[model samples]
Target chain A: MNKFKTTESFENHISKEKRSAKAKAFFINFLLSFYLFFSLFFSSSYLIYEKNILPSFFYFILLAFSFIFSLLWTSKNSSLGSMAIYKTNKFLKNRKELQSEFNLFSFSGIFISLVLILTILLGSILVDINLYLLFSSQGLSGAKRIFSALFQPNWNIISQVLSSMVDTIFIAFLATFIAIPIAFFFSFFAARNLMKNSLLGNSVYTVIRFISNFTRSVEPLVWAVIFSVWVGVGPFAGMLALAIHSVSSLIKLYSEQIESVGQGPLEAIESTGAHPVLVVWYAVVPQIILPYLSFTIYRWDINIRMATVIGLVGGGGIGTLLVQYQGLAQWNEVGTIVIVIASVVWLMDYLSAKLREAIY
Target chain B: MSKTILEIKNLEKFYENGVHALKSVSFDVKQGEFLAVIGLSGSGKSTMLRCINGLVPSSSGEINFQGQDIISLKSKELRLARKSIGMIFQHFNLISRKSVLVNVLSGSLAKVSLFNGIFAKFSKKETDKAMSNLELVGLKDKAYIRADELSGGQQQRVAIARALMQDPEILLADEPVASLDPATSHSVMDHLAYINKELNKTVVCNLHFLSLVRKYATRVIALKDGKLVFEGSPLDIDEAWFKRIYGEQAREVGIE
Candidate 1:
C-alpha cells in the first residue's frame, strides 16, 4: 500500500514539474521579446523612421527587469541560471583573497555591442550607404554570363595568357629577390637588441623602423600607380613597386627574427673579442639565415598576389590583358583571363609551400 | 712557482638597481695555476670571471693583467686583450645550426680580418688549426655534423677546443660542466685538466660541486653574498669554513 501511494505521487509530481517548465519557457520568451523590441525598434529606425518613446516609458519596470535579470529568469531553472549564480559566488569568494578570478562582469560587453549597432545605423545615414543594394538586379546577368564563359576559356589566347602569367610570376620572383637583400641589410641596424647599447645605433634603428612602417602603410596598387607614372607603364614599374613594398614588410619580420636569436651564442661571440662586423657575421647571421630564407619565400608568395593587382594600374602583366578584355565588354575573354590568373596563383602557392617544407 | 698573469685590486660592482654583485674583492692569479671559484648561484663568480675579459665592466677596481689595466681600456684595446683570453660557457653556446667545424672556426674570429670573417673565407692555416682543435676534442670525426646533434659533454669539449683556437694564455671555464652528467662532467674536467697540465694554460673555473673543486682545483676560493670569504689550498676548507661560506642551512652535494 505504501509503495503504490509513493509511485502514484511521484508520477503526479513529475508531470506538474514539466508543465511548469513548459509554461515558464513560453512566458519568459514572450516577456523577453516584448521588452527587447522597444530598444531594437529605437536603434533600427534612427534614419528610416522616427520611433514613439511611449512603449519604453510605459513598460519601464519590465525594461529594468529585462536588463538586470537578463541571464537569470530567462534561462532554465537548474542549468544556466544556477551555473551563473555559482560562478558569481566563486568570483566573490576569490575576490577577498586577491587571487586570479574569472572575468564575469558583462555590462560593458553588452554596452559595446549596442553601441556598435547604433553606430552602424547612424553611419549608414551619414554616409548614404545601402548594403541592401549588394543584391541589385542589374549585375545578376553579368555575373551569370561571366561564369558560363569560364567553361570555354578562349583556347586561342592560351599562349598569350600563359606568357603574361609567367611574366607576372617573374615580376614577383624578381621583386622579392631584390627586396630580401635590402631588407636583410636594414634588419641588423633596425633590431633593438643589436642597437640597445649605443646612441647612434638607436637613432639608426628608429629611422629604419619609421621608413619601413611608412612604406608599408601605402598600398601596393597605389605604389604601382606612382611607379607606373614614373617609369611609363611597364613590368619594370610593377617590379619596382613590389620590391619597395616588400622591403618594408620583410624588414620588420627579419629584424624581429634577428632580435629573437639566442643570447648565449651572442655572448660567446662577443667574448671572442671579434670585431663588430665579425660578431654579426659569426653570431647574428648564422642564427637568422634559416628564418630569413623562410621570410623571403613567404614574401615572394605575397608578391605573386601583388603582381596581379599592379597590372590593373598599367604595370604590365596578366591584369593588363584582363583590363583590356573588360574594356571591350569581352566577358568571355575576361573569364579566360580570370581562370588563367587563378590557376597560376594556385600553382605558385603550391610550389612555394613545397619549397618551404624542404627548407624546414 | 709561476709568475702572476692577472691581478685584481679592490674590485667593486654596483648594479643599476643597487645590488652589489661583487664587493671590494682582490686576488692574483699565477700563470699556470688551476684556480676554482666555488659559490652558491648568483654569488658573483660569473661576474668576477667576466670582469677579467672586460665582458662585464667593473664600477670601481683595478683589473691589472700582464702589467696592463683591463678596466679602463678603450674598445680596440679591449678586443685585442680579449683575443688572448678564451672563455667557455655552461651552455656550450655553439651555433646549433652550424657544423662543428664551422663553430670551431668561429673561435678564430678574433684573429681573422673583418672582410675575411664575414665572407667566411678562412685561410688554409685557419682551417688546419680548426681541424686540429676538433681533433683535440675527439670531435674530428664529427666535424661536418650539426652542433645541436652532438651530446652535451661532446659540445662542451668542442667549446674547450674552440677556446684553444685562440691559443689562449688563460682559459676561463664558467660552470662548464654544470649542465653535464657526473661521468660527462669528469670527462669534460679531464680535458680541462689536460689543457691545464700538458698545454700549461692557466685555468680559472667557477664550480658548484665541492667534490669537483677538490679533485681539479689547485687553489680554491669561496664567495658568500658577493664577498670573498675563503681563499687557500682546497684541503684547508674544513667543516666550519664550509658552513660559513655556503650559509647555515646549506648541505654539501657530491658528484663522484
Candidate 2:
C-alpha cells in the first residue's frame, strides 16, 4: 500500500510542478500583453485621435479580454504565445523541428496584432507621414516641374561640370592613395593575433583599435567641414578629410583580414628558423594579399562616393558646383552634374568588380 | 650502436587556460632512428614535439638536443637552433595560393636576407636546391602549379619537400598521415622511411595507428593522460598492454 501510494504521489508531484510553471508563465505573459496593448492603444487614442484620457470602458473590456487570452496562450505550457501561428502550415509541419516555439493559434495573437497595428498608427502621427500629400495638387505640381526640368539637362554647362567632376575624382584618388600606406603600416600593430604576445604589443593594439574606431565613427562630411575651416576650403581639404577617414577604415579592414589568417602556416614558417620579419613576409603576407587588395579597392569605391558629399561643405569638387546651381534654383544645371556623377560612379563600380574578379 | 641525439627530462606544460597538457614527460631519441610517439588526442604528443623545437614553451623541463639545453636558449639563439630541426604537420601547412616552388623555397627563409626574402628573390643555389627537393618528392613537374591545386597526398609530399629545404639533422612529424587515406598513408610513410634511411636524418613522429607504428618505427613510446606509460619495441605491445594504455573497453582498429 505504501509503495502504491508513493507512485501516486510522484505522479501528482509532477503535475503540480507543471501547473505552477504554467501559472507562472501565464501571469508573466498577462502582465506583458496588458502593458504592451495598453500603452499602444492609449498613446494612439490620445495623440492621434486627440483623446485626453484612456477610454475606461474600452480599457476594462480589453483588460478582461487580455486576461482570458493570456490564460489560453499559456495553456499546454508552450512558449511565445502563438507568435509563430503562420508557420504552422503543411509545408512547415513536414519540417516539424523548424517550427517556432508557439504552435497553437489563440486569442493572444489577436491582441499582438492589435498592438502592432496601433503602434504603426502612433508612429505615422509622430512623424507627420501623410501619403495623400504625394497626390495633393501642390506636391504633384512641384514634383512635375522639378522632374521635367531634370529630364532636360542643360548641355551648355556640361564642360564646366566635367572639370569639377575631374576634380572630384582626383580628390577621391589622392585620398585613397595617401591612406593606403599609412593604413598598411598601422595594420600590423592593430592586429590582435600579432600584438597579443607581449604587454607592449597588447597596449599598442588597444590604442590603435581605439583611435581607428573613434575616427571611423565620425562621418567624412563632418571631417570635410573641419578640414575646410582649417585649410581655407579647396579640393586639398576634401582630400585630407577623406584620407584621414580612409586610413582608419582601411586599418580596421586590413587588421581583421590579418587576424583571420591560418595559424598553421605561421607555425610552419617559424619552424624554419626565419626571423620574425621574414616569417610575416612568407606566411602572413601570402595569406592576406588578395583580401587586402580587394578591401583597398572597396575603400576607393566608397571614397569616390564620399568625395562628392564633402564638396558640398565648401571642399572643392563637383558637389560644390551642384550646391551652387541648386542655391540659384538652376535645376537643369544640377541635373547635368547629377548625371555625370551617376555615370562615373557606375563606371567605377563595374571596373572595380572586374578587377577584383580578375585578381581572384 | 647509435648515440642519443635528443633527451627530454621532466617536461611539463600548463597552458594559461589551466589545461595541464603535459605532466613530467620524459623520453630519449637516438640518432638516425625512426622513433614513433603514439597517444590518444589531447595526450600531449603534439605538445612534446613542439617543446623539443621550442615552438610551444614548456612550463618547466630540460630539452637536451645534441649537447645544448634547448629550453635555456634566448630568442635569437633559439631561432638559430631551430634551423637544425625541421617540422611538418598533418595539414601540410603549405601557402595554398603560392606556387609549389615558392612554397618549397620559403623553407629556406631562415637563411635568406630580409631584403631578398621581401622581394621573393631567391638565390639560384636555393632555387636549385628547392627543385631538387621537389624532385626528391616526385613533384618536380608540378612546381609551377599552385599548392591548393594538388591532391591531399601530393600536398603532404610538397610539405615534406619544404621541410627538406632546411636539411636539418632531425625531422619532427606531428601526425604526418592523420589526414590521409590508407593507400596515401603508406605512400607518405614510405617516403619518410626513405628519408630516414638515405638522408640519415633522425625522425620523431607522432602516430595514431599502431599498425603504421609497427611497420615504420624502429621503437615506439606511448603517452596516456600526458604521462609516458610504455616505452619499448612495437612487437612488445601485446593486447594486455594495449588495454592498459587505451582502457579495457578499447578495441584495436586497423587501417590495413
Candidate 3:
C-alpha cells in the first residue's frame, strides 16, 4: 500500500539528490570501460609467456586492435555510453566536476586495477597448457593422415562393420526404451515444485535428486567396465550400463521439465477436486509430453555415441570390434568401422532434430 | 425459499511472506443468486473466492459450503466437496497442448477410478457429457482442435466448458473477463449470466469493471483492504458508496 503513496516532500528530496547520483553513475561508466580496455590488452600480451621481442610486439599489436574494437562497441547508441551521457546532461544541466563524480572515478579505478593485478598473478598459476603439442607441424600431419583415410573408407569390411554398427544402434535403442519410463516415474518424486510441500515429500525429492546426480557424475564408460566385470563381456553388459546412466541423466532432464510445467493449469485442475496424481496426469502430463519425447530422442542420440565408447571398455558392440581391429594394425578395417558409425550417428541426429522441430 | 448455499465467517489469510492478503472477511451467497465481488486489486476479492474453493488453505476461518465446514476438511473430503464447485481463471488456464474435448473430460478426473484415470479411459457417458458441455460454450465444433490454436476468448469459453463438466452447483469466476477486450468481455459475461439464469447454478464472481456488476449481478459486495466495506444491490452503490468502496480520489473506470 505504501507503494501507492506519493507526496510533494518525496519529489523535492529526490530532485535534490539526483544531480550527484547521475554524475557519479556517469564517472563509474567511463572508468569501468577504460579498465576493461586496459585489462584486455594486458591479458592478451601476457598469454604468450615469451621473452622474444618480435612475437611479444605482435601480441601487443593484436591486443591494441582488440582494445580499439571494444571501445568502438561501447560507444554505440545501444551501449552504455549514450545512457551515461543522457543521464548526466538531464540531471547536471550546466554543472561539471562535482565531488561525487571524482570519488566514483577513483573508486572504480582502484577496484579494476586490483582485479587486473589479481588476474595476472592467478593466470601465472594456470599453466601446464602446451600449445606446441596441439599446433606443431607433426601434430598437423598426424591429423591430416587420419582425416585423409576417411575419404578412402575401405568397403572391403562392409559386412563386419555393418553388423557391428547395427549392434551399436540396438544397444542405444534398448537402453533408452528401458530408461525413459523409469525416468518418468522418478521425475515426479524429484520435482521440487511438486514435492516441496511436506517433510516426506521434500526428503523424497532430495534423495531422488542426489541419487540421479551421483549416477550421472560417473561417466557411462566407468559404469560399463564395472558391469562387464560383474556380468561377463557382451552387449548385455553394455545395455545395462547405458540404461543405468541414461536413467540418471534423463531423470535430471525430465524433473527439470516437470518443475517448469506451467503452474496455472495445475491450479485450475486442482480446483476441480482432482487428486495430486490426477492433477499430474491431466495438467502436468499434457504440458511435458512433447518435451519428454524430444528429450528421449535426444538421449537416444547421445546413447548411440556412448555405446561406442562403452564397447571399447569391453561391454560388447561396434566399439569393441573397432579396438580389436585397430590393435591388429588393421587401419583399413578401422576406417570402414569409423565411417559406418559416423553415418549412423548423422542419420539419427537428423531424424531426431526434425521430429523435435515438428513436435515443438 | 432462498436459502444460503455458501457462508463465510471471519476468513483471514496471512501468506508465508507475512502479507496479510485477507483480514476478517465474512459473507453469504444466497441460493441461485449471482453475487459479484467488487474490489480494487489486492483487496482480498480473489483470496475470498479462493478460500471458498479451498484452492489455498486459509490461515483462520470457517467456510460453510453445502452444509460442511470447508476449512476443516482433510484431503479426500476436501476433494469431494470441491467436485461440486467449479472455477474459471482470468487467464483461462487450459492445457495448451491438449484438445478442447480432452480438457473438458479432465474435469471428471476426481470422480473416476484410479485405473481408468491412469489409462485415460473415458466412458461413453463421460464423453457424451463432455461433448454436451462443449456445446454449451458454443465450441462443439472446435472440440478436436488444440486449446492454444483458439483465440483468448475462445480458450476462456473452453475453460467454462471444462468447469461445467464437473456438474457443479456453484461456480467461482476469478476475473473471468479481465484479460479480454471490451466487446468480448460483454460476450463472456453474457455466458456467465446465461449459466446463472438458465442452469440455475449459484455464481460468485470477482469483477473490476463496475459496469459489468450492474449488468449481471443480482447482489454486490465490496472489499477494501481485505475487509467487507459494502454489500447491497448493484444499483444501491451510489456516488457516496462508490467513493467509500473505491476511494475519494478514484474515478470509476468502465467497459462497454
TM-score of every candidate relative to the true structure: 0.76, 0.78, 0.76
* Model 3: how far residue A233 lies from native, Å: 2.7
For candidate 1, give the lDDT of residue A357. Answer: 84
lDDT (Cα, tens digit) per residue for candidate 1, span B1-256 = 6799999988876543235678878998999999999889989999999889987777777999877899889879989888889999999999898899888988889888888888888899989998988888788999999999999999998898888988888999999999999999999999999999999999999999999989999999888788889999999988888999898898888999
* Top candidate when judged by TM-score against the true structure: 2
Mind giving the per-residue lDDT tens digits that candidate 2 earns over A1-360?
Answer: 011112244345445544554555677778767767676777767676676466579888888987987887666434443223213332223234433453235445565566677777767766777789978999999999999888889999999999999999999999999999999999999998888876788999999999999999999999999999999799999999999999999999999999999999999999999998888888898889999999899888888899999999987999899999999999999889999999999999998888888888
Runs in model 1 lying further than 4 Å from the true structure: A1-131, A134-153, B1-3, B9-20, B23-25, B119-132, B140-146, B236-249
Q: Looking at model 2 chain A, report the run of 10 residues with the lowest lDDT sum.
A: A1-10
- lDDT per model vs. reference: 0.81, 0.85, 0.83
For residues A1-360, what per-residue lDDT tens digits would candidate 1 score against the true structure?
A: 011122234345445544554454445544544435445565556535654344546567656655545444434432222223333442222223322233334533453465567667655655666665656776777667777887667778878988998899999989998997899899898899888666788889899999999999999899999999998898999999999999999999999998999888888888888998888878888888988888888889889988999999887888888888888977777878888888887887898888888988
Q: In candidate 1, how many Å is residue A65 off?
A: 30
The candidate with the higher DockQ, 2 or 3, is 3
Clashing pairs for predicted structure model 1, backbone only: none
The per-candidate TM-score of the B chain, in the order shown, comes to 0.98, 0.98, 0.98
Instruction: Kindly provide the TM-score of model 3 when superposed on the true structure, using C-alpha atoms.
Output: 0.76
Task: For candidate 3, write residues A1-360 as lDDT tens digits.
Answer: 121112343344345555455444445455555556555555554556542233456555655664565456444333343345534543333233322232324543455566667566446645546778889999999888877775677897899888888898999999999999899999999898899866789999999999999999999999999999999999999999999999999999999999998889999999999888989888898889989999999999999999999999887889999999878856767888888888888999999899889989
Ranked candidates (DockQ, high to low) = 3, 2, 1
Determine the TM-score of chain B of model 3: 0.98
**Cα-lDDT of candidate 3:** 0.83
Best by lDDT: 2
